[model samples]
Target chain A: MIQAEHLTKRYGFTTAIQDVSFEVRKGEILGFLGPNGAGKTTTMRILAGFFPATEGRAIVAGFDVFEKPLEVKKRVGYMPEHPPLYEEMSVDAYLRFVATIKGVDRDKIDSRLGDVKARCGLAEEGSRLIKHLSKGYKQRVGLAQALIHEPEVLILDEPTIGLDPKQIIEVRELIRGLAGDHTVILSTHILPEVSMTCERVIIINNGKIVVMDTPENLTSQLSGGERIELDIVGPVENLPALLREIPQVKNVSLGEPQNARQPVLVETEGSADVRHLIARKVIESGLDLYRLSTQTMTLEEIFVKLTTEEETQEEETE
Target chain B: MRNYLAIVTKELRTLFVSPIAYVVLAVFFAITGYFFYIILGNVIEFVMQRAFQSQQFGAAPPPFDAPAAVIRGFFGILSTILLFLIPMITMGIFAEEKKRGTIELLFTSPLTHLQLILGKFTALILFLLVMLVPTIVNSILLYLLSEPAPRLVTMLVGYLGAFLLGGALLAVGVFISSLTENQIVAAVLTFGTFLILWVIDATAGTGSTITNETIRYLSILNHYEDFTKGVLDSQHVIFYLSFIFLGLFLTSVSLDSGKWRG
Candidate 1:
């Protein structure tokens, strides 16, 4: 439902996002993963029509964000990093106001208000003053406002940033529930949120999309191949050659020796199963093998590696 | 149209529910009420002294014309009071939204920039009218107690002048508020700009003939005085209308520039 092409945004001499392109299909939740100052918010803001892109084009729900912003805005609901709340207003009042401005029809407003309030777990707190509520409740109100109009596309920036763990889970569940009906583009630095809640992930770093794929694919595909961690009680000086002698074992490196147990990290080619061979090799060599386990790359590891590597590459280029 | 009304309704709701707005309104009423009582009392004392002197000389007293002397004078003071009070009412209209990041909500909505600006401007005007309730009540009291009541047409015209002048200043305040996220900065800038407008006539009086004429023409006070005199000249109406349009236009341009910048 959303397509951004060569989306570049610059603030005077500083480029916030440059040539960042991505797409979100209908009824899909796309997670934008990046560290702080990674131009995630800038990209979302451009799509929301809060500001125009310095260059490039964005189309949302078949409307050009720049040329037909009002049409695009009608179809998209955006919640910024900070909940745009009027603290003095009651929850019901704030939602009602948002519903009205979002063009919720006069007759449908009541039902929509009830629906969003219920969906966001805000039914009981409808009459409470927003300033009196905790931060989690305030976030629910923000989500409620975004959903009040039953928008076709929702762009939420760090929807769970300040919430407690329970509230975060609740918000994630709420977002996951919205997948089949709404096209969602959620941005955050949090990794598990992407894995748990999003179907597709777009990892943006330094104003560019460094990687885009399913969370599982991002981890497996980006990290090269299989890895195995071996903790052995033996003299580790000649272990690299012995481990490399196995056919599929691509490389081997020893970690620190502590209390006579040495840690060995073994790399293998794509999806290879070399555990049995390594076990037999340790036995034949008379080395005591204390611990050996296949280690798959986590999303966090891939994320840190990709983002940090991107920074290093940029530094080298500079 | 519905979007505009929605925005206006929301703005009014925010303004009325805030304790600070009421505090400012109460303080305004107290100050204006005191001035009203003092002005009425002085006009009454002057009328009585004239009656006494004329009776001793076996002649009629000069026509008091309370509408001209008192009601018009009251409106004149009302305009000046609104000079300070309008900024208080408008300082937070855009600045607060900017500070709280609610401008994102408005900008991303389906509403047009013109609709948003007009919606907010209309809300502030309505709030200014609400603020004038006590003054209206004071006028009603003068209407009831005076022997020869204030002229209905004069009272209406003078109140119109006050409203138009207040509307123009509020528009200027809205534009100033849009310039910054700091309400205090917005208020101070609005006040400074208004002070210059108020004193422009004084500056005009000392300048050369052509300069004086041009400055007086540009001065808001010059156009407003005619309305206070019960003269319904279309020129003053046009001036206030154009001033309001200019302010709103500038505000819209300022807002639309957000798309061009960050």
Candidate 2:
């Protein structure tokens, strides 16, 4: 539903986004993961037709964002970083105004207003002025405005930034329910949000996209092999040699001692089930197993790895 | 067209919702009312003096037209008061939106820049019309109280001139609002620009004849004089229309530049 080709934006001599390109498929919830100043908002604004890209083009819902911005704007609902709202207006009045300007049919405005207010949990606050609402409620009103027209694509920038944990979960549920009917592209620095809500993830750093894949793939691809962590109480010098004898075991390394027990990492081949064999071997070796846990790299670790890897690469080239 | 009307309504609601609009209205009417009282007082005093001289020395006094003397003079000062008050009405039209980050909503909607500008301009124009309601009431009372009825055509033409002049000034204010995010800055800059236009005629005699003529033509008060005289010349109409167009065109250009820079 959305395509961006070599999209670059420059503010005078400074480039906000350089050669940024990504595609979002229909009915897919794509999480845009990036650190601060990573050009995520800039990219979203360009795609939403808020402004023209300096050096490239973006197409949303089969219309050019630069040439046919009105068409693109009609199909996309964009909630900027700060929910663009008129504070003096009541919630009902504000949503009605947004629906009208968004080109919702005159006959459908009342129904659309009802649907969005109920969906965003704002039905009760309809008569209250927006400035009187709390931050979380104001944010919901922002979401309500974005969802009023039921656009095909939703470009939300940090939709759950300042909410409480319960509100966050509620918003996540709401976003999750939007899949299969709406193409959502949400950008945030929160890693677990991507892992929990998105089908695909794009990691960007310093105005460049560093990695793009599913969360699981990103974890495994960065780890290079499946890893199992082991904590045992025994002489660790011969553990590597003993664990290497197993057919499925590839490599074993012992970590530093803590509380009279040493941690060991066991690397296994692809999709191998060797935990049973390793537990049995620990019994035969006359060693006390304090803890044995199988693990893989997490999305946070992958994010740190990819972004730091880019920095080191630049340092090396320089 | 529906989008334009939607924006216009939305803006008008915003204007009425804020207390600043009430404060501006109060200040506007207070000034115009005080000026009306003083001018009418002076006219009545001048008439008494003329009547006394005619009775004592057997000299005839000049003819007095209450509607022309009071109404035209009232509107004349109304323009000067409008010069100060119109900026307050327009300073927040675009500047407040930019400061609050609501301009994003307008820009991302399926509305064109021209539509946005016209919608906002129309809302301010409507507010100006609403503000003139009290003066209209006062004019009606004067018409009812007159022994010899006032000339309706001259009064209508005079009010038309006031409306067009206020429209031109409002367009200028909108353009100034688009250039800044601070309302105070917008208001001050608008007032400053109008002040310069107001004083341009003062320098007419200091320069060469051709330069003096050009300066006199550029002065806002110079073109507005014919309207107060009940003269509906097309040249004056065209001048005010062109002034309004120039201001709106600059505002639209500023919006385009903002989009490109953003």
Q: In terms of DockQ, which candidate is strongest?
A: 2
Model 1 CA deviation exceeding 4 Å by range: A221-302, A305-318, B51-67, B205-209
Model 1: which residue pairs collide?
Answer: none
* Candidate 2 lDDT tens digits, A232-254: 99887877888888887877988
Cα deviation of A128, candidate 2, in Å:
1.7
Interface RMSD of every candidate?
A: 1.1, 0.7
lDDT of 1 at B227: 81
Full-model lDDT for every candidate: 0.87, 0.87
Which residue window of length 10 is worst by lDDT in model 1 chain B? B63-72
User: Residue A127 error for model 1, in Å?
Assistant: 1.7
